[model samples]
Every structure is written in structure tokens, then in C-alpha cells.
Target: MTVILVTGGNRGIGLAIVQAVGTRVADATVLVGCRSTANAEEPIKELKKLGVPAKLKALEITITDDASIRAAVKVVEENHGKLDVLINNAAAVTLPKSTDLTDVRESWARTLDCVATSQVLVTKAFLPLLRKAEWGRVVMNSSARGSIGRNIALELPPSPHWLYNCSKAALNLATIDFRNAEVRDIPDERDHITFWTVSPGHCKTGFNNFRGVKDPAEGAEVIARLLESKRGEISSATFWEFEEGKFQQVPW
Candidate 1:
């Protein structure tokens, strides 16, 4: 059976994705990772109630903590044996807004640690298991605010989110870098992985403290579509927009 592991899957976009995937693809079993193992239990039950195969995963992963990262990877590897899909959806923002580079140094670091560093640590920990899969799929949950093009055009809204933006931009680059290293380095082009830096747009999630204009269910549906899309592999790394029942890859 196809297996998927999703981080921060208790509520918001994460939980929605689990339900959408379960409803759309009946065969796949989704492992929902939560900070507190206890909190994850009910959600798993809810998924089961919805007739979706789901499991609760106990993983308190601070992107900055190496030991926790290793432990979570071990749990998945030992328990599931093969992780076909990994969704880097666990991220957070700190108190003070970092609208520019001149923001508090420590706050910036913390934001980057949770938002960007976590992605790198996750990829490093699960690369071996992903490579073992017949077809590996990784989705890096990003935002439109991270686009350099948007910044250049003064399109991104002004917020005191310095490290958050930096971290996402860094994550985008890391996504591309990872694809290049993992796919291009392999002698056989067919032995490759599909990695994407997709913007969830303005979604109503805790990420924006539910102040977003878009609905969480709609946002999760976009990610679900991507996972169940006809194309197995992606062509470029960019700001991807999901609307009107399609994914439009845009310039980064």
C-alpha cells in the first residue's frame, strides 16, 4: 500500500489534507505527526471516522533539534519500512514580526530555525527511506510571500516577518538545490524524485492565526490535488498557484 507521512497534521491545513487524501485515494494510509502524541490521537480517530485510513504519529520536532529529528525518522523507518511521500508542513512564526533584515537577530534566527532549518533536517533524515521507495514524492509547503520576484515587484504585503520570509526563500532555494543534487547526480535520470516549492496562497490556517481570507478546506484541497495529480514528476521550481482546478507554475 502507498504510505504518506505528514507533519503538523493534527489541525488546520494538515488535517484537511489527510481527509482529502483519504477521500480521494482510498488505498493510501496517512501518518499524521503532531507535537503531542496525545493530541494526535483524536484526529486520527476522526480520519478513521471519515472512513480514511490514518495513524497517529508522536513526533515533537523542533526544526533546530537534531536528536528529535533523528528519532522521528527512526520511528517512520522502523514502523512503516517505506515512506513514499513526505510533506514538510511543520513550521511556525515567532512573536516579533521580521519585516526586514534589521529586525531582532535572535527572533530572526528562531523563525528561520522553525520554518527553514526544519525542512533541511527533515530531508536529510528521510532521504534514505525516500530513495528506497519505488517513487518518492516530497512537497515543501511554502507561501507566496517568499517569492523574490514578488519582493522585487513590491507585491508581497508588508509584515514584521523577517525570518519567516527569509526562511521560506531559503527553503525554496533548498528545494531546488535538493532536486538538482538528488536527481542530477544519479546516473539514471529515471531514478529521480519529485520535489516542489508550492505556495498555498492565502489559506485560513493557524499559520496566519486564521486571519487569512481563503478557506482551510480549499487550501488543503489544492495540496490533495497535487498529490493525486496526473503528472508524477515536476519540471521546475517556482511559485505554483492552485486555482480553477489546476496548478499553474509561475516564475519565482
Candidate 2:
């Protein structure tokens, strides 16, 4: 069974990712990571209704907390021994429309903690389990907004998305940095781990108050596709965006 863990799996694209994996990969064990397992009750039932062969396990993980992060790592280590895939999908989106610099600063700090810093902590805690697997895979659910070139190409006027966009950009760089470090200090085994940053498109989810253009299921396709990819078929540290029904390389 493929032991896979997806953070923020309680709703939106994260929940969709759980279903997608259940649909596509048989015998997959999915650890549905959430901040609160009690809040995940309904979603867990829904995923079970999908009848995917994967086993859904609830993992309590508050990404912003160190103790929570370590506890999550312990659960997986004790039960699964190793993790085949790790999807850093938990991100808090705070829409700061305020023109005041103080408000912007506050929102920026909060969003960055959840979206960027927490990712580093979570990945650090789980790297041991990831390394135990013969071939591990790490994915960061990034955004096209993270790319300045894309923003210019789309002719979008700069707004209050500075904090959110910068956070994602930091995540993209983290993906690249982690991959390069792993490759440089690669183990003797040929089954090396890989990393990827994927933009799930502007999905109609809570992140945008359900005002986005794409559907959540559609947003989940790229992550599901990447999970199903064969080893060596993907380029580590490459940033991708699912555009025009296909995965396109995005400029950093």
C-alpha cells in the first residue's frame, strides 16, 4: 500500500485530493491531516462514500504548532513505518483588502506563518519517515500568483495579494532548495526522493470565497496526476500549473 499524507484534507481541494487518490490509486493509505479531527467528521464520511480502495485515517496536525507537528510525525511513524508521499497542502488564506499598512503587516505575518513557515516545520518533522521509504515524493500546493511573470502576462494590477503571493513564492523557493539539497547529498540508493510545486489553478473554493473560476475537483487533478506519476517521470523542484486542461511549466 502506498502510504500518503495530505495536509488540510478536511475540505476544499485537499478533500478533493483525498477522493482523487482514492479513485486513482488502489490500496493507498491516505492520512487525512487536519487541524481538528472533530471538524473532519463529515468530510471523512464523504470520502468513505466515494468507495476508493484507499484507507482514510484522520491525522490531527496544527501546522503552526511545533508539538502538533511532532505528534503527527509520531503517529505516521508508529503506524505506517514510512511515508511514500507527503503533500504540503495546508495553507491559510487571509484576504486583506485593507489599505492600512498596519493591517497589511498583521495579515501578512499570519498568512506567512501558516502558508510558508509551517510548511518548513512540517516537512522537517516528516523527512525522517520520508527518507525511510525507498522512493519518496514531496509536493507543495503553490499558486500561479506566486509567479511575477504570470501576473504581468495576465495584466493583473497589483493589489493586496502581496502577502499571499510572497508566501507562495517562498514556498516555491523552498521546494527548489529542498530538492537541490537532497540531490546533492543523495543516498547511494537509486530510489531518490523528488519534490514539486504545483499550482492548482484558481479553483472555486473558500480560499477565494468560492469566487474562483475553476472547480475544486478540477484544481485537484494536477495533484492527483502528480501522485500517480512514475518515478523519474517528473522533474524535481519544477514548478507546474494546470492550465488549459494540462500541466504547464510556470516561471519562477
lDDT of 2 by residue, 1-252 (tens): 889898999898998888888778768899999998986788888777866678888999999999999999999999999998899999996656686988777788889998888998888889989989978889999888787677778755465677888899888889888987887887653656788998998888888789888888888889888877888887888887777877778887
State the number of backbone clashes in model 1: 4
User: Model 2 residue 146 lDDT?
Assistant: 83
Q: Which candidate is the best by lDDT?
A: 2
lDDT of 1 by residue, 1-252 (tens): 667777887888878777777677547877777777787788777777776754444455545678877888888778878778888888887755544655566677788888888888888788888888887778888877788888889877896666688788898888888888866688775567778777777778777778987776677765676777654445634457675567777456
TM-score for model 1? 0.89
- lDDT (CA) per prediction: 0.74, 0.85
Estimated TM-score per prediction?
0.89, 0.93
Q: Which runs in model 1 stand beyond 4 Å of their true positions?
A: 53-62, 97-103, 230-233, 236-238, 244-246
Backbone clashes, candidate 2: 0
Candidate 2 yields a Cα-based lDDT of 0.85
